[model samples]
Target: MTTIPVIDFQLHAVGKEGCVELDNLGSEMCQALEGIGFCYLKNHGISEEIINEAFRSSKDFFSQPVNEKEKFARSHNYNFGWVGLEVEKLNPERPVGDYKEAWNITLEDHSLEWPSEKVPNFKPSMQKLYEMCTDLSKRIFDVISVGLKLDVMNCEDQYVPATPIPGTIVVNIGDLMQRWTADKLKATKHRVLNPSNEQQRRQNRQSMAFFVHPDDKLMIECLDKSNKYEPISSIDYLNSRFKATY
Candidate 1:
């Protein structure tokens, strides 16, 4: 099977006059994405220090008492806080709860209330990681957009993918993006697994997902260049997708 492949941004270092790098990297990326919708991205530009420190903060937060973490329980359609283990079933089509947990973050707006005092230094560190990853996501998306012949600048500015590979952060396509692309891109189902070894299980597994989305009212549909999908509201799609979880 063509499973999730490891891809790097070396293509980016090549000169623009030659499409070789872009051509090769773009084809490889598109194939893996179309096959599994997930990829291991290397040289994504997010520093090792950023990911390490962020994970440290995440582990500390999850280590807090259950009650404290619950304070950020997903409210309304805004999935912006801690999700307790067994609280979510990624594929509700099945009968089991996902063995993983996560914290969903989004853009910081006036409406984006920050529950300060919950975890010290959490906001500052997280905000830094958020901005870095957000920028990286767009760079990777630029490759995908070009591979598909879609103008990267005209495509959604922020993107989401998944998996944490030590120095590399994972990126994946989402339901909204899939629907918008008429499944031209896949929203692959993925999850983090608890360490099976006794020793490994003792160590905590903490991951953070920066779920970036376009403005709420933006109309979403397959682009005019590819009119395979019907129009839908961006915010509505995000809310509806999250409702299926848990």
Candidate 2:
């Protein structure tokens, strides 16, 4: 079995004073993020009920008939709406599509917006979850800035306006983090999965993903440590990865 590490952020939140030790908590987080691109964050301050609600709503949405879910597909923008089972191929080279279904939403300026009108109910639950995740994301970013010895608000501009939609788990790719960390940190890759088989599909299983992108025109580059880290073009990386897997 493959296991991903969960770094408890609550420890840092409550132990912020003690975390200044520099070598202990800071290094630990850096290492974990750089290696896995994803970590389970506990003590993140998002309520359990909110998380549960998002998941429950997602399941309900996916439970709908294929024709119903298709009404919400945003194949054009790749921003918001529903994605059917195996509709999104993450790895082309792998030649295997996942058996899953998902819905997406974005947050901007503390407001939520769905790309398509088909999923009307997406907004309410998405907004609730977005608020929680955005808040937690800000707190985590602050700690990361402090850990990197950068201004506490160094990464603030990146999150402002909070994107159009927000939530408990914000699915951001590795490209932005690579720029922010000068290639030292990675944006993790994750995909939604239909955990149950065909029979369960009738019952409906849905996953929600909230992906954050840098402003369209913004260019990300290496920071002060650019020389130390090898440069990888975000566009090329994404294209290559998608080609190989999807």
Candidate 3:
């Protein structure tokens, strides 16, 4: 069975005492995030109802025949909209495609837009979840910064001007951390599974991933003074490895 480690949010919500404990947790969590690129975040402040509702809505949206889901398929950029099973390829180096169906939503400056007309109630439910999750992600990022002994807001820039991208839940990892960790920690690589597969389809499994990307125009490079590692362009790194096949 594939398992993602669960990091408890409560560990960091209570201030100093919490922060202290989380300092220890951060080491383990960062190691997991670096090695696996995915982890199960338990005790996340978001309500179970919200998580279930988001998943339920996603399942309903993907359950519609392919034609219907395609209506909202991302256009222009590879970022937003509905991605069908075997439609998004994650690793260009690997020939096989990913197996999954997903509905992606993203926010910037706390603003969100969803295809409500097509997926009734999708906009509101997702917006609510995004707000909550964003807050949670920020807290986690802070803990990571402290764990690494960098300034409190050292990692803040990566998430400040959020841009949308796919994966089941929101993901943040980019040039900033690459520079900070000297390539020791890497941004996560995640993909949705094609819902058409018998086992997955039978279980009605569908995923929603929200990736918080840096502003499209932003040029991410390692800081010179912090030159603990070789600098690399974020876009080049992402493009070289990620080729969405669904």
Candidate 4:
């Protein structure tokens, strides 16, 4: 089994061309992402305090009664609010929908329906973590560019779960990225299953996933010069997928 690679993302030192560290980091990141579409990044600059507080906020919001959480329910036209459990079935063939709930956050604060009245810290805590994740993503994109020598910038069945490591964040490529890369990078299928351990099943799992999509108006075309897939706008592609799952 190819275990997920753990990369030391020293963003501060990766810019210099021909540096041994940069080459190695670039090589490792690209290889891991290509092989499994996933890697764990260590030495990433985000502080643990911010991460912990965000988790606390997520837990607080989820702990509320269903009726209460429904107050901030997601709107039909946008994916910027609370999504109840079982409302999403990523795998259509599965007997039941996913056993999880999620609150999709966007950069537009006014567009999101915040649970401020109940969880006062939700907005600030999540927003802080969101910005940090965005910054880290841009840095990772830089590393990928160096790895690919690009002049311009951008599996569930039998799936293996990434083993958690302290002080590391997990990164994975999405379908748009794979399409944009013309399959040079894998968009391996993935799904979260219920924990097997009886004791662990009773516990709540709090996670923050930052979905990075290009601007709605931006076009996504094959960057590797392979016309394997047709070009599509970010909004159109995202809407197609969301319509299927939501």
Candidate 5:
């Protein structure tokens, strides 16, 4: 397996570093996105306590009986809320759904419903983590945009492995981003695996993802640097992708 490149978030954080550091990190990000489409982010200022709390809450939420989870089933054709295993087939080439349970949250144009009554402090923890991750995402993009000379970068996002690697955030490019950039950045393919052993199966995987979807009506097009594809609405693009995957 190829090791994903890890990028230091502080290099681009305000006043934390200088242009040389930012440009270097940007170059690394550019290559990583174009090549692997996935990277590990660290030192982006999300506290250890917050990550732990989020994970704990997520595990607790997923641990609940299926009925409790179903209450927050996704609605409005939006992808936020609880998604059970065998529901999302990330890779059309694959014959099975991803072997993990997930909860998705989006900052704008919200449709997220939570089982807050059952999971104490769930809302607060998720909100804080979402804010921090979005902050990190935007700054990281700012660095990449500056380096690539794009006006701005989109904020779509996802989660990574569950291991307690200190200060680690897994960031991957989505299909919409791939479309927007005309494949300048690839949409990484990732999945949670079926447990191979009793010990592995005991650890039911749960993840929280912050997807930064652009407004539904906004036109998504290849950047000016590369007009390889025509413009399409973000919603239409997402619908086509999800319809095929689901």
Candidate 6:
């Protein structure tokens, strides 16, 4: 029964009090990712209010009729938009596709597509959350860079998953990071399972995720230079995965 580590992000966000513990914080985070490929971050700087608002907005969006959601249906060319239920097969070997639906918000400079007429706050709340997450990710990368003593920056495990802890952010390492680190870190296979109880099964589960990817044109190579994986462009890698998913 191994448990995912819970790292207090306040240690990194704090000023004078956190200076001495920064290295230890990075080490703890690295260990968690290297060992389990996931960790829960507590006391992250993002406001709880923002997180709640985003979820509320997401729920509202999902509650709309399928027709309305289809107006912004995602395209293979543009990855940001409404993604209907069962549209993805994260685990290719699974008999069926994923059961969840999603709405992707773009990180590009283009105008966002939102059902503002229906859920007015959806745009603002999600935008704010996106910005906060972007900042937090940069900080996390900085810590990892120092911890690994590198000059450049870079699981479904068993049936058990990290239990939900209030005010904590669950960070999962992705394929890119695993390759970038030359297997120093892990990118685990995971899937969302249905609730065990009938009561819970009837309710909709709301979750939010912020994916951080390097520029589309950026080339990704193995950081350790061991050639464990071949170098590829960000967009090319994403396209290949999307092909398998859709």
Best by TM-score: 6
Decreasing lDDT order of the candidates: 4, 6, 5, 1, 3, 2
Report the Cα lDDT for candidate 3.
0.57
Which tens-of-lDDT digit does each residue in 1-246 have in candidate 4?
Answer: 257888888653223234344566787888777778899998888888999999998899999999999999888866788889899878988888788899987767565668888899999998988888887887788788777633322232467868679888999999899889877777888777678999999998877788889999998988876677898999999999988897
Per-model TM values vs. the true structure: 0.77, 0.63, 0.65, 0.89, 0.81, 0.90
| Candidate 5 lDDT, 1-246, residue by residue in tens | 146777777666523544455677788888777766787787777778988898888778888998889898766566678778788778777789866677767654243557778898787888878877777767877777865644333323554453435567777888788878777777766665666898888865655566767788999878864677888898888788778767
Q: How many angstroms is residue 156 displaced in model 1 relative to the true structure, after the best TM-score fit?
A: 28
- Deviating ranges (above 4 Å) for candidate 6: 14-21, 149-157
- Model 3 CA deviation exceeding 4 Å by range: 1-5, 13-22, 34-39, 108-115, 149-180, 186-201, 217-219, 223-246
* Candidate 4: worst-modelled 10 consecutive residues by lDDT: 148-157
Query: Regarding lDDT, does 4 or 5 come out ahead?
Result: 4
Error of 2 at 72 (Å): 1.7
lDDT per residue for candidate 1 within 47-76, as digits (tens), equals 778777877777777777888888877665
Candidate 5: clashing residue pairs, number: 0
Return the lDDT, model 5, position 122: 81
Model 3 residue 104 CA deviation (Å) reads 2.5
TM-score of 3: 0.65
lDDT tens digits, residue span 1-246, model 2: 033455566654422344334345555555555655554555666666777777766666666688877766755534456666676676555565666666656543233235325545556776888876656665566555555532111121122121222322332326657665665565655543443677876764434444444454444455665454555565555455545533
Off by over 4 Å in 5: 14-21, 108-113, 149-164
Single out the weakest 10-residue window by summed lDDT for candidate 5: 149-158
Q: Which stretches of candidate 1 lie over 4 Å from their true place?
A: 10-23, 109-118, 149-164, 224-228
Q: State how far residue 229 of model 3 sits from its true place (Å).
A: 5.8
Clashes in each model (backbone N, CA, C under 3 Å)? 4, 19, 18, 2, 0, 0
TM-score of model number 4: 0.89
Model 6: per-residue lDDT, tens digit, 81-193? 89998898888788887888998877662675778899999888888888888889888887777676333222334744667899999998899988888877777666777
